[model samples]
Target: MNTARLAADLVEELDEGGLRGSFLVRDLHTGREIGIDPDVLFPVASLIKVPLAAATAERIRLGELDGSAQLTVQPGRISTPGPTGLTRFRYPARIAVDDLLYLSMSISDGVAADALFGLTPPAEVNRLLRAWELHGITARHLLGALSDTPAERLPAEEGHLAHSLAISSGTSGRGHRIQQLDVARANTGSARAFVDLLQALWTTSKIDAVVQSRIRELMGTNLLRQRLAPDFTSDATTWFSKTGTLLNLRHEAGVVEHADGQAFAIAALTESRISAVHQPEAEVLMARVARVLRDHLRHG
Candidate 1:
C-alpha cells in the first residue's frame, strides 16, 4: 500500500471541504508511518492533559507529591467554565488527587484538569517534555486559563443570568480568535511531535512501567469517541486516546491496538471554517479520514 499517496489523497479531500487538517499514523509493530502536514502546529485544546498526566505521574514516582492525598476544590477557585465532572459541581468538594487525574484524562474534565495543573505547573510539564526530548509540544497554560472569560474571573455575583451572559460574550470573543488558529496564544503541538510523545510513552524504559500503564488505562476510558475512535475501534480492536476540542478545532491522539497484535499511534487534528457552534460533519470527517488511514496501514 502506498500510505503516502493515501494520506495525500485524504488531505486533498479535506481541503476541498474547506477544512484544514494534519494527521500521522505509525504502525508500532512495523515502524511504518504516514502523515500529511503532520509537522504543522495546531491548537491542542484538552489534548494537553496527556502531558500533565505524565508530569503528575512522574512527580508521584519521585515521591515529591502524593497522588492519594485529598484536595479541596472550591467552585470559583481554579475552576474552568465547562459542564463536565468537577466543573458542574455547585459547591466545594474534596477529591483525591489521583482520582482527579482520572477525571481530567478519561472525561476531559476542565476543572479537574485545572486542579492538577495547579499542582504540576505548566512550566514543570514543559520542562519534563524537554528533558524527555519531546520538543515538538508545549504546555503553556492551565485548561481553565485557556477558555476563561474576563467575566468568569470577576467576583461571583447574585444574578445568575447576568453572569451567564458575561461568560457567553467572553467565550464568543475567545472562540473567534481561536478559530483563526492563533497558535502563539494557545497550547500547541504538531502531529509528528505528538506521535513521538506517544512512542516514548509506549516504548521508553526511562519511565516507570506502572506509570505508563496507568496513563494508557485512563486514556482507554476516554469518553470522547466521535473523532478517531469511532472509525478504528471495535470489539477486537481497542483505542486508548485523548481528545481536544475548542470552537472550530477537533483533535484525537492515541494508540490503537488490534486483536491480532498490530498497534498504531495516530494523531488527527482538524480545523473547520464553519462558524456554527455545532459542526457534526467536521467530527465525522476526522473519523472517516482515520478509518482510511487505519485500513491502508492494516491491508494496503
Candidate 2:
C-alpha cells in the first residue's frame, strides 16, 4: 500500500464525508504526527469512557471501591444520547459492579454508565481526575446531579438566604448560568494527551497494572463492530480500541499493534454539519483515516 498517498487521501475523504472538526494522527513508534488540529478539544461523546475506565480502575486498585459489589439499577439512570449515555435496561434492574463496567465499556451501555456514576460519586470522580493529573476532564452537570446530597428540612426563606449567600460569595451566579445552558457538545481531550494515556495503558503505568490489562481487554471486546474494525482486522494485527459516535460526530482512539510488537496509538475524530442517522458519512471518514494511519505505521 502506498501509505503516504493513503494518508493524504484520508484528509480529502474527511472533507467529503461532511466532517467539520479538528483531529490528530500520530506514529507512536517514531513520534510522527499527521493532522490539522490535534490540541483543540472536540466533544468526546462516549470517548469519555477512556478516562472513566481509568478513574474506576484506579479506584479499585486503591481499595477505595469494590468492583464485584452488586449495584441496584434505578429508573432515573436512563439518559438521552449525545448529552447523556447509552441505556440498555428499562425498569428496576440490579447488576454487579463488575458486570456494570463490562456493560459500560464493552457494550457502551448507557444504563450501566449511569449506575457507575452513582456508585462513584462526582466528588470522588473529581478527586480521581485530579489524582490522574488530567486537566479539563470532569463529569458534566447532569452527571454531577447523581452526587449524594442530604435534604434537610428548612424554612422557605432558607432558599433565599442560600442564594443571597451564594451571590455574596460570588460563586452562585456563575454555576447557575452554566447549568441552565443546554449546549449539546461532547467531552474533550487532545491528541497528544490522549496518546500519552494510551501509552500509559500499554505500559501499564499511571494506574494499576492488573486493572489496565482488564481495561485493554474491555477495549478489545467493544461491541461496535461496524466501523474501523471491519476495515482493519487481522490475525496478525491486534486493535485495542474505544469508539465513539453521536449525530454527525464519529471518533475511534486506540493502539494498533503489528505482529512484531511495534504499536501506535491513534485517534481520529470527525464532526459533520449535517446529521446522518446511520452516520455513513462519518463512518467512511473514520475508516479511511484508520486505514491510512495503520498503513503508514506498518510500513514506516
Candidate 3:
C-alpha cells in the first residue's frame, strides 16, 4: 500500500479504537521514517521517566551525584503502588541511586522517581535535556503530582467518571481542566521528540556516552510489556521501551534492534476517547499500528 493510504487507514483504525494518537518510527541507520501526526504534542505521562533517568545518569557520570550513595525513603512517603515497590515498605528503607533508577524506569515506580526527582529537580532535568540539544519535552513537576488526579480521588467503581471527565474536558488547543492532561502545564513531549531522544540514546549524541549506555540499559530492563512490547519483542530482536499511562493517555517509546543489525526507534503517544479505563483492545490497536509502521519502514 501507498504511504498516504496507509496513514489514512491507520488514523481510521486508531479512531475506531477510541484513540487519537501520534506515532513515529525511524530507521536508526538510514534515518528514514513514517508516522501519523508525530509532531503533535501530548502530556507524556510516565514516559517522562526516560529523560529523568537520562538526566540522573548524566549527573552520576559527571560525579555531581553519587549513584552508590544510599538515600532513606520513609514508609508511607508515597502511595502504595498497584503492584509492589517502595510504597509497600512498612519501614524506612535506604536505596542507592542505581537501584532507584531500576525501580523508576524498569518497573515504572513513582516513589522511586520522586526520590530521584528530589535529588535532581524537574527544572534540572529540563535543563539537562536542553543542554543536550533535545527539544519539545518539558519536565515541570515530580511524579507525585500525577497521583493527585481525579482518578485517585474517585472510588474504585467510579473510576470511569474521571476518565469521562478527561475525555470531555479538553480544548481545541490541547488545554484541559485537568492539569496533568494539559500540555502547557504537565510534563509533555511529542512522538517526534521522543524518537529524537531514542536516536540520541541508541547512537552517538551530545549526551555523554556513559550516560547514554546506562539509560539504554535501564530501558532494556523495562518490565511493563503489555503495550508495544508484544509487537516488537522476539527471539531475534530486542525491544527496549518505556510505557506511560495517566488517565486516558498511553504511550511507549523505544528502539527495536533486529538480528541483522537493523534498528528502528518508535514512539506512540495516544489518548483514549472511551470512558472506561481497562481497554485491552486499545493497547492491541496501539501495538498493531506501531508494528505496521515498522514493517512499512523495514520493507521500503
Candidate 4:
C-alpha cells in the first residue's frame, strides 16, 4: 500500500466525520518521512507535557534541579480543573520531582504538569525548545488556564467545573468562547515539529542516555492506549507516547519501535466539527488513521 495515498484517503474520511487532521510518519533509521498537512498547527492540549518533561530532565542533568527532591503540594498550588495522581488528594502532600514527571507524562495529569511548569516555567520550557531549534512548537499557558472557570474557581478538587467546561466547549458552535480559548491562545504545534522532537529524543547525543531512557520509560507506561497504541503495539513492538485531549482536539505523538530495531516517529493531530459532548468515533478514527500509517511503513 502507498502510505501517502492512504494517508490522504484517511484525511478525507476524517473530513466526512467533521474532523480536520494532520499526520506525519518518519523512519528514524533512514530519515525518510511522509506527511499530510504536516506543517499545519493544532491546539496540542496536554501534548505539551512531553516538552515539559524534557525540560525537567535537562534541569536535573544540569544540577539546576533535583529530581529526588520532595515538593509540598499545597492547596491552590496547582489547578487544572481535573486532578489525577497526587493532585486527587485533599490535604497537602509531598511528592518527588521524578514522580511528578511520571504523573504528567504517563497519565496526562494536569495538576502534575502545572506543578512542573511552576518549577520550570512555561517561558523557560519554550526557551529550552528554541535552544534545541524546535521553533514551531510553543508551550504558552499553564494547564490550569485551559479550564473555563475563573482563576479562583480553578482549584476545585472535584473537577466539576472542568467537566462542565469540556461539555460546553464541545457542544458550542463556531465562534464560541471555547474557540477563543483554544484557537486563539492555546498551546500549539505542528505534526512535523513534534515528530522532529521525538526523533531528537530518540537519537540525539546531546541528551544524556540515562535521562532519555527514563523519559521513554515513563511514556511507555501511558495508561491511555486507545488512541495510537491499539493499532501498532504487539509482543514484538512497543510504543512510547503522550496524548493530548480537549473539547474537540485529540492528538498523540510518539515513537514505535519493533524488536527488529526499526523505529518510526508518528504524530497525529485532529480537530472535530461535531458539537456534541461525546464523540467516541473521533477517537476511533484517529487510531484507525494511525494504524494505516504504521502498517504502511512496517510492511511497505
Candidate 5:
C-alpha cells in the first residue's frame, strides 16, 4: 500500500472509531518515521509525571533535593481519586520522595504526584525542560487541579454528560472552558514532542544519565498497561510507556526496544467523540493505530 493511502485509511478508521489522534512511530537508530498528525497537541493528563519524575530525579542527581527525604501524607491529604498508589491508602503514610516517584509514574497516583509537585512546582519543571532544550510540552498546574473539574463533581448518571461537555466545550485554538482540558492551562504535549523526549531519554542525551535511566525504569514498571502496552509488548520486545486520561482524552507515549537492538519511539495522543468513560474499544483502537505506524516504521 502507498504511504499516503494508508494514512488516509487510518484517518478514516480513527474517525469511524470515534477518535482523532496524533500518532507517531520512529526508529531511533535510523530516525525513519511514520505518523498521523503527530504534531497536533493535546492536554496531557498524568503524562506530566514522566517529566516530573525526570526533573525530580535530576534534582536528586544534582544534590538539590534528597530522594530519601520522607513526606507524610495524611489520609485527608489524598485529595485526588485514583485507582492505585497512595490515593487509595486510608491512613497517614510517610513516603520517601523516591517511592513517591515510583507511585506517580507506575500507578498514575495523583496524590503522590502533587506531593512531588509540592517540592518541584510546574514552573520549575518547565524550567528544566527549557534548560534541557526540550520544547512543545507545557506544564501549568498541579495534578489536583484535574481532580477538581466538572467531571469529578458530576453525578454517576451524568458522567457521559461530562464527557459531552469535554468534547464540545473546546475552541479552535485548543482553549477550553475547563482549565484542565485547555492546552494553554493544562499539561500539554504533541506526539512529536513526546517522541523527541523519548529519544532523549533513550539516548541519555539532553538529560542527566542517572535521571534518564531512572525515568525509564519507572515507565517500564508502569501499571496502566491497558493502552499501548498490549500492542508493543512481547518476549522479543520490552515496552516502557505511560498513559494519560481526562474526560474525553486518552494518550500513551513510550519506546519499545526489541532484543535485536532495534528501538522505536511511539506517541499516540487521542481525543474521542464518544461521550462515555471506560471506553475499552477506544483503548484497543488507539493501540491498533499506533501499532500500524510502528510496524510500518520497523519494517521500512
Candidate 6:
C-alpha cells in the first residue's frame, strides 16, 4: 500500500474542499501519524462525549462512581435542547450509569449526559479531564458559559424542562439583547489534543481494557453514521468510531483494529465550507482519509 501517496491524496482533497483548521491521523499500533495539522483547536461537537465517557469510567474505577448504579431523571436534570436532551419523555426516566454512558456516547444522548452531570457537578467532569490531562480544551472550560444557570428551563420546543440548548438555536442567541446562554461554541478542542486523548484511551492502562472496550462499543452507536465507517465498510473492516456534528462542524474519531491485529487511531475535525448548514462534506473529507489508510495497510 502506498501510505504516503494516500496521505497526500487525502490532504489534497481537504484543500480542495476549503476546509479550515487541523486534521490528524495516526496508526496506534506503529505510533506513526500520517496526516497534517496535528495541533489546531476546533469545535469538538459531540466528540466531547468520547473523553467524557472515559472520564466517567475512570471515576468508576476509583470506586468514586458505579456504572450499574441507578439514577432518576429529575426536574433539575433538564438541559438545553441538543441531540440527546429530553424533548419527549412524559415522565422522569430512570437509568443506570452504564446506560447513561451508552446513551451519551453511542447515541450522543444529551439527556443522558445531563443525567450524569446532574448526579455530579461540572467540576467532577473537569476532575476527570484533569486525570486524563485533557483539561485545557474540554467542556469544563465552557460549561460555565454553556450551562451555568440551573433554573430548570423547559425545552424550547416542548413544555418540559430541558437545560442545554441545541446547536442551531444556541448559536443564534449569541450577542443577542435577551438574557440567554449561548452555547453554540460551548465546547471546543484542538484536533491534536483530541487525538492525544484517544491515544490515552488506547495506550493507558489506567482504565481497564474491558472498560475501554465498552467505550468503543458505545461510540459505534452513532445514529447518523456520517464518518469514516461508511467509506470503509465495503471492505468488511471492523470500525469502532464516534461522530459529532454541529452547524459548521463535523468530527469523527476512533480506533480501527484490523482482523490481522493491526490497530490505528484516527481523529478528523473540520469546519466545513458551508458556514450555517450541516453538510456531509466534512464527513466526506474524513472518508477520503479512511479510504487512503485502508488502502495503505491493505496493499502493504
Best by TM-score: 3
Winner on TM-score between 3 and 5 is 3
Which tens-of-lDDT digit does each residue in 1-300 have in candidate 3?
999899999999999889999999999999999999999999998999999999999999889999999999765444423534775566888999999999999888887888999999999999989998999999998887777889878887898999999999999999999999998899999999999999999888898899888988999999999999999989999999999999899899999999999999999999999999688999999999999999999997
Predicted candidate 5 versus true structure: per-residue lDDT over 1-300, tens digit per residue: 777888899999999999999998889999889899988989999889898999899999999999999999754343333446666678879999999999899889888998999999999999999898999998988887767777767776778898999999999999999989988888999999999999989985889888888999999999889999999899999999998988899999999999999999999999999998779999999999999988877775
Q: What tens digits encode model 1's per-residue C-alpha lDDT throughout 169-201?
A: 334233333322356666789898888878878
Using lDDT as the measure, the top candidate is 3
Ten contiguous residues with the weakest lDDT in model 6: 159-168
TM-score quality measure for candidate 1: 0.86
Candidate 4 lDDT by residue in tens digits, 1-300: 566578779878888987788988899999888777899877788889998999999899889999999888654333443345655556777889989898888878777888899899989999998887776788888876644443235454444454455435532322234542354566788999899888878997455676677778888889888788887789999889999877556899999999999999999998776654457788888878777776677677
Model 4: runs farther than 4 Å from truth?
Answer: 1-4, 75-83, 149-184
Cα TM-score per model: 0.86, 0.75, 0.97, 0.86, 0.96, 0.74
Please, what are the lDDT tens digits per residue for candidate 2 over residues 128-159?
A: 66665656544553232221111112243343
TM-score of 4: 0.86
RMSD of each: 5.5, 9.9, 1.3, 4.3, 1.5, 6.5
In order, candidate lDDTs are 0.78, 0.60, 0.91, 0.78, 0.89, 0.60
Question: What TM-score does candidate 5 reach?
Answer: 0.96
Worst 10 residues of 3 by lDDT: 75-84
Which residue runs of candidate 5 sit more than 4 Å off their true CA positions?
A: 76-83
TM-score winner between candidates 1 and 5: 5
lDDT of 6 at 26: 68
Deviation in Å, model 4, residue 259 alpha carbon: 1.4
